[model samples]
Target: MSRKPSNIVYAAADKVPLGTLISLGVQHASLALLFVVYPLVAATEAGLSFEDTQILITSCVIFMGLATILECWPRFGSGLLLVQIPNTSHLPLAVQSLAAGGPALYAVMSLIAALSQLSLTFFTGALRKLFPPEVCGVAVTMLGVALAEPALRRMFGLADQGGAAMDLRYPMVSFAALVVIVVLAIFSRGPLRLFAVAIGTGVGWGLAHYVGLTHGPTGRALADLPLIDLPQLGWPGLAFSWAMLPAAILTGVISAVDMISTVVSMQRMDDADWHRADMNQAARAIRPNTVADMGAAVTGGFASASSSAAIGVAFATGTTAWRVGVVSGVIVVLAAFSPRLIAALSVIPDPVVGAILVYSSAFLVVAGMELILSRRLSDRRIFTVGLAVMAGLAVAILPELVDATPDWAHPILGSPLSVSTGVAIALNLLFRIGIRQEASVPVTTDDNPFEATTTFLEHQGDIWGARRDVISSAIPVVAEAAEMLLDTGVAEDGVVLRARFDENDLDVTLLYRGAPIEIPTLRPSPEDLLGDAAAVARFVGYMLSKRADRLLLGRLGERQTLTLRFEH
Candidate 1:
């Protein structure tokens, strides 16, 4: 039998929802390792001491792990169920910042970014109201447009010595791979479609290998590594550099905006109600993330980028609880302890990962676009929303325009896309022509609908509010009685007692005990004893507690006072 639900439950405990969490953990670990390995490779080729390379590697791994932990297990008041990873989106900019001023630039940027994420939390409520469906849709769609360049690079090849790919032929390879993936995704059923990214990447990898174009180094040195230990936490030496402060702050702001968008998107996707309990759950989840984000920024790992993957995992897995988060944290810890296992999996190559990212992000873009399109916008409003979205994309993809801006202005303009969103939304509101008015409709009641409802509430003797349906049938009677009592002037001194039901038994008396009262009646009535106002109140209280739908009320003997019996 189906029981009436008080609240909507999005997920139930049934499936292995932990699969996506585990997959995301593994994927993040793989990405972070590349951050470490890529730098090490660069240093080695540049004739830097192996000791320096090892230190860099250790620093990156430790900080990345710590950041992951912080994001998953926050310590603050609100726990956002999200994780912080190195922002692959800022790879080019980060590298540039690093080369310009070394570790100082990186540390400074991260610190600013951490502060930005925290600050963004305050505006979350306002943001929800402003973006709604339309603005978010366009902004998210434009985000994908901005990301196209890097994705293309991954599919083809990194720049050659002359600043081009080893060959331009791989664009065709990448496009072909994308086509196959899209076709399978569109036609395949269930799990096959969901895992299309992985399958497509595998196929793409095979083609690359067969064509003798996948000429990357082969090594098995990082096998059989251990999988558990204490986390290393420390500050970066260049953290205090004033010169890098601006960059750090800029990065922080961008990260915070991205994090906000991610969480909001997840909330919508999972259809989270954002109730008190859900908010509390989110707060609990965000504690570790705070630490992780700050740690990664300070320690020169990846630029901190937060995402609501834990919540997404819960929704996807059909489990709306934190147990899965704990499981994900454990998996990450195990991977941190086991380096060789990660190295073995790293054989998938950068292009494959890039392909997967492109596919997923494309879906996000489309989702965002659909949201914006769903809004009722006039032609002028559409142009405004569209221009704002495009402007955001321009700012996000091209940061050089911001370089010339003043120090304080960086925060205002650093995250070109987010800043654009804010500006465009504000401007759109300012340019609005007029406010639309809504007409009110009146409802008529033949009998006072709230008449019995008032008596029911009076009998229960509770204060404040009650549900509409509980009073639905009784309201008319109670309202009529109230009007009659007012007209006759009997209500000035005496009180009316209302019983919920007319069942013959001692159950009604047992539920509400009160002093018996005798009264002269003007006309014939049913029942012998007249229950007092207190008795009526008790019956109503019982009904309210049990969430009863209907209530019964009538006069005792000839007495004007009524008894109430609530039906559950």
Candidate 2:
């Protein structure tokens, strides 16, 4: 049986009931709060005063809200439901910069990095060739793998790197939280499943309190926080330092890669017809992200990027509406000014935070694996991805190896993410030196049917031994069918047209999710063609039947496949 597509609301432009929107908004806000750990860890590591830490946190939250709004904006954003937050991958580098030259220098480094990302947006098309799926995928997977140690450290009460003994109770509490989260994620349904992280955190916090294991700020301390305090605004004291440049550049590149992957993931979750990312759209998405990072730096916050955790929440809740993201951003902005709320959140048990990190990090790892495995894994791809992952894991597991590197190269080689990304990109490019590139292009509604179809046919002609005349003739036929699909609104986003060339025939399959389309063989009468919308449909059907040698439509689950075969 072909299961019907779910009527779940999706996309930035899609509308949902007000009540549901509000609920989803709150869910997104809760999930986004997990990012607070980034700035908190940075501040603590930098040995900043309580007041200074509060300022940094405030700036981070406010700018994150502003960024999320920009990311959801129709003109500027990727026009997808994306939530922006501090980039965890940059945390170690951020700490290093902060330690090297105070908050001002750190801010300057972040600013430079943001500018670099902004510059890269201009060359996104070119960069895509270098940073293909395998490279990006390995880097992304390594990011998750790298995060596992920190998560474990927090879970086991060994977060203080200065040889703090593990607290026996920490693992018990974190494990309980992990179990709760895993159970809820696997067994719960709908909104409850989306709240697994929040719920699990609460459960862990309760257990820690009951067991007298809560170690951070007490509730009494939070109560002392003032109800309202205006945010201190000023340009981060800028200091030019050559030592920071390498880290800045590496951070910018990593941020761009993360943004691309995150945006693609969000789009896939929101749109059923999204087969592959629209690189142009991904480039557009990076512009506002760089702007946000610059904004954060100016306001005394660390570097920021899109939040995968929030995207995971959206996927879980089936809430991809831009309005929900807007509301969530508003909530964060409001929370920023509330000192008590900030203080309370700051006091969340470390074990609970660790549990949440574990939960979210799992998603990042899976997303990365999916991206790498999206194509057939030939030996070349396997080697490219395997080497990258192994290299990244080596760096992540062995801190001493990074320390052994020269000081100047530390910023680039110290982080597992940087190492993995570099290795994957280098290896992928090296392996492709003599190999012929495949003729494949991602399709979206914004693409021109005539151009895409003609390119596909021309490329396949050489491989299939089809005559130029036959291949040329099939272009219009394919283009018209694609036009028909788009014009009739049969696919929500667009279809992926994949061409397979065999010895006897060249087959082009259009993969999309929609109702089964009926192709008409007989030409429509003049009166019928001149009538209504059905007339247009009949015309498309008649055209397809006349031009195609064979047309086959099949449905598996919700996906509808249209295959056109032309005898070579």
Candidate 3:
């Protein structure tokens, strides 16, 4: 039977109402715009004139908008409703480039990173093997953790922004905004639920204005802005540095990892019967971002990648319609030419931004947990997940480690997603050693052969990192075969069970000193089954034939063998 995506109001290709699309676009554009602060900080740190800063910010906004549209194109993007934005992970590298060589240098570095990501498209088919669900989970978990800390700090008025005085209203307004969003998303139906995030942010912004949170310099900044403006291209760096190459290339790799994980998450959201990662589709999805990022480089913008938070937040609306992404992308592009609109978004109170981020973070953290637990875990896998998670948190939770790291290492140290994913890949590879594809064990009638067979293969499946669905389907067939061998007295003394597993197939063989179970090509008659024990064995063979992909009756020297093969 065909499977339709559940909990979805509108799927990717659905036609959304014009009004709903416009509203959803505004909400998404606003969310994507929040990351503008990263580049704003970079421009501020670079000490550029107000004009130069606008140019830089405008370039980023333009490319981000373009990226959003391209990411929905099947040839270029994951063909899902993924919002693209200025990457927060690239902040350290952006700051470094802007300081050392200006926008031109940063543009060149970004181009290099984009090229690196483009090169990765060739190997997307192998990415799933390299980053299994558990590994992707580690990366995603850290991505969420990375988002939560700064957001909570700002929301609670704990972060020192220019040593400003702490405000009690920050928590009050932010928490209220959060509750509003949560309640609407969880309890409301139809359009109310669809616009939950947009409504919450609007309420939060209104409260911020009413409470005077934006009445200070923030208000002044927006008030002074013109209604509309044209963008100027930022400088091309006259200087160059080989020292930055490692970080730039690593940036590309990080972007690929982020893109792949986001694509996987989207695939799961789009398919109710999802059981495994589809690397081919993941490759197709990431191609457009790499292309968009290349455009970003020449335009003097930071490299762009998929926003996992945007995916999580929008999913709450139950409409991942590709049309929304297209409309949202167009809105972002149009907003780039409007100085006042950008200014208004830029001045959103820190606490409100925190509330929205906190809302998005819940989805990310939970998705990561689900991906990690999607497969069964053995002792080795448990340690791999545990240690990798702790490694990511160590970087995210501890201030001292980031401080102790030299400035050159700051880019890596600042990105928990990168650190955790790198650790997960390394540890996963290291743990793969010494695990044999083939295993053997003795079986007898004394114990519950069914339970023993179940326990044995389940353990092996975990360590082998086999597909959960394949492992699940194989279990009952093998267990039932084992029970039949002992119960039917085909093997009076006992049986020797041997199993072999690989990426493509699972083969289980029972060797015993007895007559072979018949490999029946057709169903036996009920009257034939009533005649003798042989007829019953034939009936058992017919049932096993239907259960397994393939069955063989043969001999292993002096003993008979029953072979069951499952396509993995």
**In lDDT terms, which candidate is top?**
3
> Against the true structure, what is each candidate's TM-score?
0.59, 0.74, 0.90
Which candidate leads in TM-score? 3
**Pairs that collide, model 2:** none
Model 3 earns a TM-score of 0.90
Off by over 4 Å in 1: 1-83, 88-109, 129-131, 158-169, 172-186, 189-194, 220-235, 238-243, 272-287, 297-300, 307-329, 338-347, 378-383, 395-416, 428-568
**Residue 137 error, candidate 1, Å:** 2.9
Candidate 2: worst-modelled 10 consecutive residues by lDDT: 1-10
Q: List runs of model 2 lying over 4 Å from the truth.
A: 1-13, 44-52, 161-168, 271-273, 437-568
Q: For residues 1-568, what per-residue lDDT tens digits would candidate 2 score against the true structure?
A: 1121252334567786777677777767766765787888898898877766766777888888888877777687777788877787577667887777777888888888888778877886677666666665776676667667777787888887468667778889999998887887667776566566667778998999998877655667767877777775556688768877887887787788778767766655565544345667777778887787788787787667887666555644555678888888887788787777766666677787777667667767887887676544556778888998888888777878989988766766667777888888888778766554324455678999889888776755543324455577678888887877776777667877877753246677777776567666677777865666556766776767667888888875677888887765
RMSD versus native structure for model 2:
11.0
The TM-score, computed over Cα atoms with residue i paired to residue i, of candidate 2 is 0.74
Question: Candidate 3 residues 1-568, lDDT tens each?
Answer: 2154767787777788999989988888888887887788888887766776776778788888888887875556656788887887677778888888888778887888888877888885467668888888787777777778877987987766557777888998899888888888888999889998888877888898788776423556667877787766755544567988777888888888888777777766767776667787777767777777777777666666677768766677887877788888899889988878887777778788889888777778887888888877878878888988888888877868988987767787667888888888888889989999888788888877777888888888888877677778887887777777787787878888888986567888988898877867778988866766677778878898998999988987999988889876
The window of 10 residues in a row where model 3 has the poorest summed lDDT is: 214-223
Give the C-alpha lDDT of model 3: 0.79
Q: Is candidate 1 or candidate 3 better by lDDT?
A: 3
Ranking by TM-score: 3, 2, 1
Model 1 — which ten-residue stretch has the worst lDDT?
A: 503-512
